[model samples]
Target: MRAVLLTMAALAALGLTGAVAVVALGLYNVSAVAGHLPGVSWVLHTTFRNSVWLRAPSEEEVPELDDAELIALGAGHYATACVPCHGAPGQEASATMQAMVPEPPQIEEAVAHWEANELFWIVENGIKMTGMPGWPAEGRDDEVWAVVAYLVSVQGEVAPELELQTGGSEPEEYCASCHGEVGGQVPRLDLLSAEYLEAQLQAYRSGKRPSGIMAQAVTSVPEERLSELATHFAETADEAGDAPVASAELVVKGEALAREGTRDVPTCLACHGEREDGRRKGPVLDGQRRGFLEVQLTLWRDGVYAYDPLMHAAARDLSNEDIEALAAYFARR
Candidate 1:
């Protein structure tokens, strides 16, 4: 027993000495340009893969990802949030990004190796020591899943080029990329009141709303152009017709919820419904896309929209079913 104890003590002392030596002598290479040794690289990558696999949710846990609308929404977000780092269909990543150690891989090549859930996990909670960042919009799991849906659909295909309206100012051109495009995930701006649209744009620009995508988009636009962009969109007619079919039962449930408030929750109509004085505290939710409504409600519930405490309070008691119903109800209008 004494001999065994002595041997264990000597091994511990040796490990401590090696650790102290590495720190004191600066034996470890910390330079990004130098890159990792082959063995070290192998270990990090293997650990990363296994960690993602283990932590990822099962296929059943993820909502149906085959929806065309969902994939379209994902594509718009990808163009804004991801294109710089990973590149898209025919585009190549920037030269500086290519030089990053453990450089970001093209989505086509990388998605092949990961399952849908694994992709979701990586996108929602970014990998450390790699340049990949998690979704910038807080509590936006729906958006993350949308990106995953896009990845699944785009594996063997190049992304289609979305048309932006031309003959507009540069700021309007930027707005057209997402809002003007038909069948996009974002709400149809044409159906919204100009005042509401302008307010939201101002909120995004001022950081009152927490959307990395919108915040960055508005940065390039002059403050004066915000109203012009809003007017252009508001005057444009909504060509897209009818919300996608949802469960009739779900829609019915949603209608009841929207029309009548429970003991704790207020009627959604009180703020969103028509007012006699022509005042609206909330954006018009009627006829908006279901996915966008769901995401925004979730954001409100999660306290991401700090500007509207009433919205946060209203959304606080909402169950997932309640949210789905509300979105379905408003979407059909």
Candidate 2:
């Protein structure tokens, strides 16, 4: 028995040594340029597919979400959140989006494959290694379920003139607080994409994105504004100086860093520019809000945004200086 144990230990040690050697020698290609080996791809694909199946609740007792209500809420949420990465009819995921290593899959084609519970799980908990972000703030299971219903039912040709589908109007206070014209107009609602606008409101409603003020403010706003607000914003583009404008000095510094990374960082243009259709592994930064950028960076720094390993790795390396500089630069562009 002792002889057998000794042999087993020896084999284990050999395996460990071989594994360490592979790492030490940098045998694994970490480059986005390199394609995943078929076997490696299969393992990852299967694991994701099966893990969703295993984790999702088997019973079909999801809370009652009205089909019409689900579609309405889902539209709002998708407009704000999903459209940035996944896109919608009459909108395309940016050229840069095409280059994501695994790529954010188009939802219409892909979402149908997932069961409602599985979809809920993915939205609530988020898929690891992929860029799919979990609900932003957490603890709103009901809202998460609402989004799941929307995605499952959403399909084919968003009507351009669809009136706000829900029943009531937004509370006067909430509209005035953000968009009363005389209000600081901090949200830049005018320039927002309709799809983008709806998604954000839904996130706030669902507690997917962190916004205490938004939650409190919009919670009382009737569901109709979810669509009305989104549609209104969608129709209006850059109604004022809503686009980000970094200070000249900050812009200079950020532009240099973004277009040409210094000794430590990589250039944004290299991965995101015309050469690659902005489709490389990095997400497209064009036209995204400065406020949103700041929030995401903050999430990255704090280790809360766990949607993708690449983001974690990138954020881990960024210093406060980098974050401020990049935020300022992207905001201006």
Candidate 3:
């Protein structure tokens, strides 16, 4: 028995020594063209599948993936960041992406193999040895969920109609893809001053605002065109802005909160309301969508957006109900 144990220990030490030699001497092929050897592909794929299955978010933690706005937001991100590798419906993966070892699979069919939570896990935390990157911004699972929402739709094989589908590579076209329609999920650009819009674009460009989606989108836009893009959106809000979804009671409650100052919380309109000067820096909230407003307000209040000290102070004490009412009121206005 002792001799058998000794033989086992000797074999283990030999295996360890061989592994170290292989790594130190760089004996293994790392070239993409060479690809993984025989069973190596199976081992890597199995590991990834099990890792995602083990770490995926619970059903309770996963948000509703059927929301239209959520899916649209995801599609916008996919267009800019992912369309290159994952190609949209009827689009084939480019030669460069196909050249990659174990190349990126077209997610439409691939998505059906995984649950939403597993998809969320794979997106939020990228796979090892694969080119897939984790969600660009940290602590923004909401944005990650947007990608999951879109992927879920693709899994169903029904490519969603993207906000009328503005198709182009120009800066204005990209911005209009999500912001073109008034009373849409994103804020109403027409209601905001050019100065405010320009500044926000500059902020997005300079990384003062940390949105993974916006960061990638604005990076492609030329520096000089920031103002041009802002002006275009601000002036061209031809579509009228109105409440696509808001109860009368909710709006009334929101209006009262906006008009009257609570002892601890200032009125919403104190700073956001019309200023004496025709030109101002404060963003106009009058016609912004309730969903968009709620997200921005929550981000400001929770310190997720730490750049604006004043907004942090203003939004500090707002409860979920307060945010909902304020959002409803702004949408109605």
Candidate 4:
């Protein structure tokens, strides 16, 4: 028994020594152009598959992917951030993309292999060794879900029902790609003051605000053009369909909260351009989408927008019901 144990220990030591020699001697190829060793590709690919499957969200956690607005938002982002490397329906990966060590897969071909949850895992967390990057913003799984929706719907082809513009020459057009036409949760940009819009854009650019979608949107936009886009959108009526409908009761509940403050917080009107206080610098909330308002308020409540300590403190004590009422109230306006 002792002799067998000694033999096993000697073999383990030899294996460790061999691994160290390989690294210290630079015996392995590190270049992208150089091919992976025998069995290496299989090991990596299998591990990636298993890792994604293990970490993907459960069925209950995944949101329904059938919403047109959700698909459109994802498609617009896909055009901006994904098309160059992953390729759309008709487009092939660029030569530069093809030259990557493992090479990126065409979404059309690749997305079919994985389930929606697996795709979400890959989109949010990214893979270990491949050049694919995780979603740019932390704690923004909503943005990642949007991308997954696109991948699932695209299904190896682009369909006309997807009204996304693939490329834009001007900054306004680029801004419109995500914020125009198909509005469900996206805000009514036309209602916001130009100053507020510009400040938000600047926050996105400076990383004070975190949005995977907005980060990608702003990268192509020149700093000077951010003000221009914001001003133009603020002045122009967006084709975001009609005003969303809310029940009279919900609106009434929302209004009372907005006009009157609870003991824990100030009136919503004080900061949302209804009053002349210093907090009035905040965005004009009237006519914004109810869903968008709810999301923003929730983000503030969760302390995700900690850059503004005042706003953070103000929203921290809000209940979900309070948030819903406030969003409904301002949206009806």
Query: What TM-score would every model get versus the actual structure?
Result: 0.80, 0.47, 0.86, 0.89
Predicted candidate 3: what Cα RMSD to the true structure? 3.2
> Which of the two candidates, 2 or 3, achieves a greater lDDT against the reference?
3
> Candidate 3 lDDT, tens digit per residue, 2-58?
999999999999999999988999988788899888999999998888888888989
With candidate 2 superimposed using the best TM-score fit, by how many Å does residue 323's alpha carbon deviate from the native? 44
Q: Top model by TM-score, which number? A: 4
**Candidates' lDDT values, in order?**
0.78, 0.61, 0.79, 0.80
Score candidate 2 by TM-score against the native.
Answer: 0.47
Candidate 4 — which pairs collide? none
Residues 28-103 of candidate 2: C-alpha lDDT, one tens digit per residue: 7877668687798789889998998898876566755444433454455565456667766445567766877677
Alpha-carbon deviation at 70 in model 3, angstroms = 3.0
lDDT by residue (1-333, candidate 1, tens digit) is 999999999999999999999999999888888999879888999999999999999988888877766676677667666777787765667787778888888767778788889999998889999978876666667678878888888774744553322345487666666665545357778778888889988988887787756765676578898998889999986665345678989989998888877676668998898789976657788778886788788888878776877778888778888998999988886
lDDT of 2: 0.61
Per-residue lDDT, model 2, residue 131, is: 79
Residue 297's lDDT within candidate 4 is 83
Candidate 4 residue-wise lDDT, 54-75, digit = tens: 8898968888887767777788
Residue-pair clashes per candidate: 0, 15, 0, 0
- Please give the TM-score that candidate 3 achieves against the real structure: 0.86
